[model samples]
Target: MWLFLSALVLLAAARSLDWQAWLADKSRQHLCFGAAIALVPLWMLQAGIRDGLEVHFLGLTTLALMLGWRLSQLMALLSLLLVTWFGIEPWHEFGANLLLGGILPISASYFVFLLSYSYLYRHLFVYIFVAGFFNAALTMAVKTLAFAGYVTWSGQYPWQVVVDDYLSILPLLLFPEALLNGMAITLLVVFRPQWVRTFYDRDYLINK
Candidate 1:
């Protein structure tokens, strides 16, 4: 299932990506390099807050905003593979990690982006709040629930303990997740808006 989803992501990227546009921009290589290279260390720097629950900052909302969902999904798959390759994560857990850790948060981030785009006014603040901070917090919440659900369902962790231990510290993660993604988006929107695919000057800045 993981391999199949990765393959589907490849296909989606091929169909959605502007191949010519990307090929024309040599600078995008640097951005890709920065994201891909930096994320390994960030992803690996995890804290085992509980027996089976590990906490890591998922900086994927920024990645999705920068690369767009298709490419971002592809990046997510690649990131997991790279982490597994380096032995940061065991090989057996790759599928579950890719689905729960990679696909879940990335997809949730994009979903938040879409909802904001559809319902809210195309303002800079709205984008930052909805697509950046809110998205990150919401994604983290969903991811936490998902991981908790999986552990409970698999009988790896008892429901009562998972609720008390694993779920206890969840609220503490939200603000930091929001800050990480919010600050990154704010910086990009302020300094290098062109790099963020979801940002547009005409939509976000024209009125201001």
Candidate 2:
């Protein structure tokens, strides 16, 4: 699968660069800085098919906001340009998606991170679990609405078809996605907390 290949490429690149060492170097950090800039467009292309450019832009923007104000601005510009280049949706829809994705996840991550450290660590499992659940729920909700409109206008399969065909498999899909996202976040926080931006002085509490 293309997804598997992409993962392999990222892993191979990380290994070839000795990313652990590179993470500590100021120059390499700048390279990451630029790559992060480049990532906006690439992420948009990857995410555009399922969620559209708006959602991808919003998600990246939200992540950048968690970093800081200045960085957020920079990322916002990059997101805008990337979304425009993709031409996947109207500008208004793009803006709305950006707002929804950016605000919701960042706020959720921030509040969760601000909670007790033990909870922050342990509940991250819960966080990703819930994220997966919510993502599935929201996706189903949107699809249901869309299907309803289609049936209303064209007199297609009854509403139950949507549930029977789509909702049934959601749990299976959600569990793995949640577990993977949780693991990724956990590894990043544990090994590369500095790159996370929002991980500030409070994170030091764990070691101290």
Among the numbered candidates, top lDDT falls to 1
- Write down the TM-score for model 1: 0.90
For candidate 2, list the clashing residue pairs, or say none: none
Alpha-carbon runs more than 4 Å astray in model 1: 2-6
What is the C-alpha lDDT profile of model 1 across 1-208, one tens digit per residue? 7657646656776788877877788888667656766678878887865645888888888998998887787777777788889888878767768778877788889988999988999999999998899999999898889889988988888898888878888999899999999999999999989789889899888967
Q: Estimate TM-scores for all models.
A: 0.90, 0.44
Residue 186 of candidate 2: its Cα lDDT? 54
Model 2 scores a TM of 0.44
> Candidate 1, 145: how far from true, in Å?
1.1
Question: What digit string (tens of lDDT, one per residue) describes model 2 on residues 115-159?
Answer: 433453443333333332343334333433443444434444455
Q: What is the C-alpha local distance difference test score of each model?
A: 0.83, 0.42
